[model samples]
Target: MNPVVYTVDLEVRWRDLDAFNHANNASYLGYIEEARVRWFKSLSADWAGETAAPIMAAVQVNYRRPVNWPETVRVELFAERVGNKSLTLGHRILSACDGDVLYCDGHTVLVWVDRGGQSVPLPDAVKAACAG
Candidate 1:
């Protein structure tokens, strides 16, 4: 298992619940996105709106179990791979009440791009910051 480099604790909102009484499938992505964005912010205050920002190239998620409301969720993020122009992030979402219950796990590929949307090598600062 990859070491958790960053983490965010989130509550499963009432609106996030589905007809089955568990968090909706789409809500999982939002949870992971929150953690990912926070990770970038930790790297730099201006990372979110910088001229050369990173964008998601692809995402793969595996749902392991259902999550219900009233339970806190812990999102763990790890920097997996850093490439010339991209970085892969590994993530795990688990029930805060019991860390052993993994609700989901996934990976996201992010590509650095300039304002013009042309691919560019990740800034040295980002590369160094995310090195694990």
Candidate 2:
């Protein structure tokens, strides 16, 4: 796996948990979104156009353990591969300090699209950012 680990620490609120007191499955995707959005923002002047957030063509997530609320959790992201028109992004959820505690793992395929709804090559700026 060409895993590139990117960590994002999220503070769990009471509302983030379900009736069982663990983070809901859907919350994990939200965590991925946080990391992905941050990465895009950090990449200078590349994917940004006149409008719209990046689009996802596909995603795969694996839940390993339950995350309790009021705890600070870390979400780690990595890309398995980068294709001409799409990228395969993987994510691992942890407790930040404790890398051994894995809450889940996920992968997402983000396609480069334009306003006209066509797949384009990921801008050089973004590819460069990922390379580094």
Candidate 3:
């Protein structure tokens, strides 16, 4: 198992559900994104600056169970790997009421990009932040 570096609790909204009364498939991506953004902000307050921002390159998600509204989900984020120009993040979305029940799991790769949207080597500061 990857080490969890950050975690957040997000509420399931009514609109997130589908005809089956469970969260739509696309909603899981938003949940993971919320955790990722929060983790980035925790690493650096000015993480959104133009010159050294990261962009999502790819994402892969596996749904384990359905989630319903009026519930709180726990999203755990991990810094699985730090590369020269990218960061590989692992995530687990669990049922807040019961931590052992996993709702979804995924990985995302973020590439560091410059103002012109070209890939660049990650900054030293960014590396240091992930080292923890």
Which candidate leads the pack in lDDT?
Answer: 1
For the record, the alpha-carbon RMSD of candidate 2 to the native fold, in angstroms, is 1.8
Task: After the best TM-score superposition of candidate 3, give how far the Cα of residue 30 lies from its true spot, in angstroms.
Answer: 0.4
Where in model 1 is the C-alpha error above 4 Å? Answer: none
Ranking by lDDT: 1, 3, 2
lDDT of 2: 0.78
Model 1 Cα lDDT, one tens digit per residue, 1-132 = 767789999999999999999999999999999998888888877674667888999999999999987899999998889899998999999988899999999899999899998998987767877776
Instruction: Give the Cα-based TM-score of candidate 1 against the true structure.
Output: 0.93
TM per model? 0.93, 0.90, 0.92
**lDDT tens per residue, model 3, 13-92:** 99999999999999999999998888778778777676778899999999999998778999998878999999998899
TM-score quality measure for candidate 3: 0.92
Q: What is the lDDT of residue 3 in candidate 2?
A: 48
Query: Each prediction's Cα lDDT score?
Result: 0.89, 0.78, 0.88
Q: How many backbone clashes does candidate 3 have?
A: 0
**What does candidate 2's lDDT look like per residue over 1-132, in tens digits?**
564646679887777788899988888888888888877777755565764235898888899989986778887777778787787888888887688998988799898787888777887766765675
Candidate 3: regions farther than 4 A off:
none
